[model samples]
Target: MADQQDELRALLKDSGEPTLERAIAKAREMVDRLDNVTLNIAVTGETGAGKSKFVNAIRGLQDTDEGAAPTGVTETTMEPTMYLHPTMPNVNFWDLPGIGTPKFKAETYMKDVKYQNYDFFIIVSAGRFKENDMILAKEIKKKKKNFYFVRTKTDLDVTQEAKKGETEEQTLQKIRKDCVENVRTLGSPSVFLITSENLARFDFQELVNNLERDLPDNKKYALVMSLPVYSKESLEKKYNTFKKAAWAVAFASGGIAAAPVPGLSTACDVAMVVPFLIKCYYSFGLDDGSLEKLSKRVNKPILEEVKKSSLVSAIADKSSLATKIAAKLAVAGVVESVCSLMPGAGSIAAAGISFVTTRSVLLEGVKELHRVAEKVIEMAELK
Candidate 1:
């Protein structure tokens, strides 16, 4: 109980998970289930700016044509269209209709689109960032939130311009500068050039990296883990974060020690925790691009975490082996009452401590997950 109290205090310090005592008690009850997390992305731009296409690209969806909120010359999307995360169902991309078309008033337009629900905004444009974009950028900045400019259709535009006889170097340089210059109109704009057709081109990797880097450690870790592996660096970074997050989750779940039943701690994890992690990923903005990439790397179908009961089962089964032992050792108070308790072993308490405890067992699991992800990342190189 004392051990559980300590862990609860630690996990609840900044967790915002109600209260530590109640949380633990509740967690103990949820060993068989999981929770939820939600991430929201907003796409907005003038009509014909390819916001919908960009959304589809980031999501690894085929095309944003028909039944996809429309991506043509005319403003096919009259009102905000919300696309649920193809993989992580809880996460969503809000296509906040077109804003640069005629008669766009910032305040009313934002209201019409229900702007408050989004976690961040991506203002996309095909040609150049416009005055309407800058005005909204200013408003977003003033609101103390985040926004990114996605220069859509970079593949077509750059290819056409370069084919007109400009050297590849000159064409690339001109386009880069042009995008930068256009975004400069808005205060502190970081432009990401991308093509919905081929996310491998332009700055899709850069954009994803920046988004992860700009967040807090936990958030960055969550975001990175949820995203697909675009490069070796991305794979490695995500592995590092996943390892860290796994450790953190273990650290938080350590309080399972307080539960009276030997494996009852399992219930706390299955119910309150494992779900919390999946939810955390969603809330951290899990999407199809990330899941699809993860699937490709893992060589398995990637479903939204919400639909991943099999994953929960796997986690429970895998973790049960370790947690049952941890709880048993805790119940026995094997550490304090031992220096000579390990039959004939020296520093028996230390030896037992080395084997049990949240940090040690969890460290092994984290390493295993990392190893698997790294191997998968390596395999992708060949394919």
Candidate 2:
């Protein structure tokens, strides 16, 4: 109780709310904004440019995975198709129609796709950039929006060039030089060389870094959380994002006592905490599906190794509902255990859980998940 009062006083002072109620209300509003931020990405390219495959890869899905954007030699996206991120629904990828087609002219492509709705655009091409791509890039620029050029199929290019006695580095440099020369008319914008087969290789992470620099804070958070943990760096990005948001989540969940959840014995809202932790579970690639995929990719028994963590095991066991119930119990147990260890925390009632206590649980949970994710990355040897 004393801890709660002191924390509330600090919040009120820092927030300049003049009252505890106002401070808590402002904190909830901040949390709400973080939870609801949306990002709509527009991907445009010529037909057979591998745009659909790139879309699926960015969303952490294989080409044949359920809900992946359709891909083929011919145009598969005739209209703007929105594919929601499997975990972060607010982050959407819009696969726009292929440019330079008779039906969809490059000049009119942005208008046809309602370009105003998207945050930015990515112009993808399997080979050299086309005139239509340049035209579309200019159009997007004229509209005061950002667009990036992506050259795909670098893996195939590398393999084919290897048969010609060219080194991998030579082939990559040649491709990059060709792409830059082709788009030199657009002031030589950086063209990301990528392969949907393996995002950890080549310049996918660099593309992400550029996006992180360009996007607004809310949208950046959504993008970071939505992307797959392909490497240790990507996992660390997720860990930092979650760590930064922990205070807001804790305040929102513990500021007021909500209705008791099924298994929670504490005042902290297990409902809020469960979803946040589960998001971390998926974002950090600790879920069963993610682990299974990694395990198969690395030809190792990673799932079993990761499931050794009780928190992970609890969140990943059985069906989704069962998992949620188990996660709630596990989180409640953590809260109880944490409270027992904190001096004077045992005297606090269900309605009086301090923000400090909730913050500790959330940070600790995120830290543990991060450690497990880092181990997975190390075991898989993902660069």
Candidate 3:
């Protein structure tokens, strides 16, 4: 029993609060923020600078994915068009109008787009950073918000340059040098070169790192959780983030005065546990739609491979998680099924739903999702 208390305390350490009540309060706040924080990113540039593709790529979608911003050689964004992240609704990408029209003016462009709504701005350019791009960058800086410069269609550049007897490294260096020289007026701000068709290549991860470093703590988690799990390293990062939050989840659901849940050996609240697992499901990209998309992208049978795990199969079998498992009745059924296997589960009370038990269940769920996600990454040969 004493060991159980120690385990619970260790789990709650991430909350940084002294007492159980305070820790629970902080845990609730953290969980709520994780579930609902809003991150609005503004993707703006000249016409045909690949803003729409960048928006789609960052949101873990292809240009052909449903709800993706349309891309074309002509100006597609006549106004500030909002594109919500497919899995994370609160995190939005605002595709703003091109700043390179004939009568282009930075102040007017900023006002036209209602620039106050975005967390940051990404200025993309296909070739050279022009006078208009510099003007807009200064305006965004004056407003005291972070801004990044991106050079798009880098794959085409590399392919074209290779024909001119230049190696890929030389081409990349030449491009970066030219871009840096152009943006020198902006205090030598770093420029990211990327191809939206394949984000795992080039400087996409570096860009994500910079953004995560600059964002506030809560927003950082939102940004990280919303990114596609593209590599083993990325999967591990997501797992660690979820693992760190497990204690908060356990305490928030089973600690203190939680209501008794029927059919469970223990009387802890089932509502929190259900949603937390669902969040894991989405974050780990275990849903059928996510897996299907991955399968199609990699031309592999990843979805079938992920279903090999019983826990993953349980969630994957359902067409709609909200309808099939998020319901109270459905979650209670899960509780009954999961708890029946535990030795002391039948005798546990609401307040006596030991921290060890809650933590164990959460770890099990997170690990299972992590396992399936790793398998998909391996089978798909994702970087």
Candidate 4:
């Protein structure tokens, strides 16, 4: 009996700490995984709830033409339409049409829209949450899905306007006044203000962050990246998004890690660079009204911004697009490569490369970005 007891003690000693520790670690991991899943948001309200516009706003679209839900006083959307995040499939923002269906009560409406699949519900109202809205919210809470209220369309005329002496901005203010007054009537704790067309430009980021904060780290980052550009803060977030995406594209391109075996990784890099350039161009309104704005910048003929004659540029020693792009790419790549390369003198080489390249690239990008920013600022100036 003594010998048997001693053997049992030795067995316990060998497995005790590590076994317990692993079990504890796994429990923590499971806790994290509980919130790692993709979240779907269902947006529903009465007819003409600006649901379409809200969808566009969430997606970071500037125009409402593609976003406006078929608006009418009656059943416009026949069924639940899924608008999955175009780039990120794990998250889809749903647009459910005409929530207060004539035959369907608020509770039943949730079932029609497949509410079970959604992580949250956003019951939008152009004015205020009606009886139907409250019922839907109450039922959703009972079933354990998070719900939110969006009061949309404060950018239009409120009370029957005659379009008299008041300006467009004045008309907008009046509408805002009416919309706010309406929301106070419902008196719900979970309420948010947004415009369907400019959701990303206003309260959308706040909404996203609120929803994502409690989420697991990976899911949170993914959700944040899909939001549209509205402010410098959002843009900064986008830059990080681009950095991650670029690295992802590189990783997906297979082993550039082992150097070239006579392949077109250079071309791949060039293609990857295109997204960054396009991002910059769109940011500065370069492809938008930026050139027209540039025309006004010099206080000269519109054609002057385009350099009507290359012969004139030739004498000035100014570079063309290809040269500039190549230079910028070189600066970015060489600087990045230094810190990434191998040890000892390699480290020293990387430091030197990083110092030189970063300085040059930063200066050039800043100079270009500043010039474009100035043109935009000037364009935005009041006439």
lDDT of each: 0.55, 0.78, 0.75, 0.50
lDDT ranking from best to worst? 2, 3, 1, 4
Of 3 and 4, the candidate ranking higher by lDDT: 3
| Per-candidate TM-score against the hidden true structure | 0.63, 0.85, 0.87, 0.54
Residue 180's lDDT in candidate 2: 73
Error of 4 at 67 (Å): 7.5
lDDT of prediction 1: 0.55
Best by lDDT: 2
Error of 2 at 30 (Å): 2.3
Largest TM-score belongs to which candidate?
3
User: What RMSD, rounded to one decimal, does every model reach?
Assistant: 8.5, 3.9, 4.2, 13.1
lDDT tens digits, residues 1-383, model 4? 23423432343253243442343244335324422457677888877777766775665443323433444336554777777654455667887865567655565887777788887778888776787877777778788877777777644433235346666557556655655665465453545656664444334556666777645555555566566444555555545544443323332222122221121122223333333444444443334233443344335443343233232122123345434454444543533442343223223233222223222333334345435444433433311
Candidate 4 segments whose C-alpha is farther than 4 A from its true place: 1-39, 62-74, 157-188, 200-202, 240-328, 333-340, 343-383
Give one digit per residue, the lDDT tens place, for model 2 in 322-375: 335435545645556544533433343332354555666677778878888888
TM-score for candidate 2: 0.85
- RMSD of model 3 against the true structure: 4.2
**What is candidate 3's lDDT per residue for 1-383, written digit by digit as tens?**
45555655675575577766676677778777777789999998888888989988887787788887887757643767898877777989998887856444565877778889999999998899888889989889888988998898999999999999999899999998888788788778989998888887788788888998999877888888888877777788789878877766777664432433444434344456556777788888888888888888889988877777666765665565433332333343434543543444433332334545566557767876787788889999987
Candidate 4, residue 24: CA error in Å?
A: 21
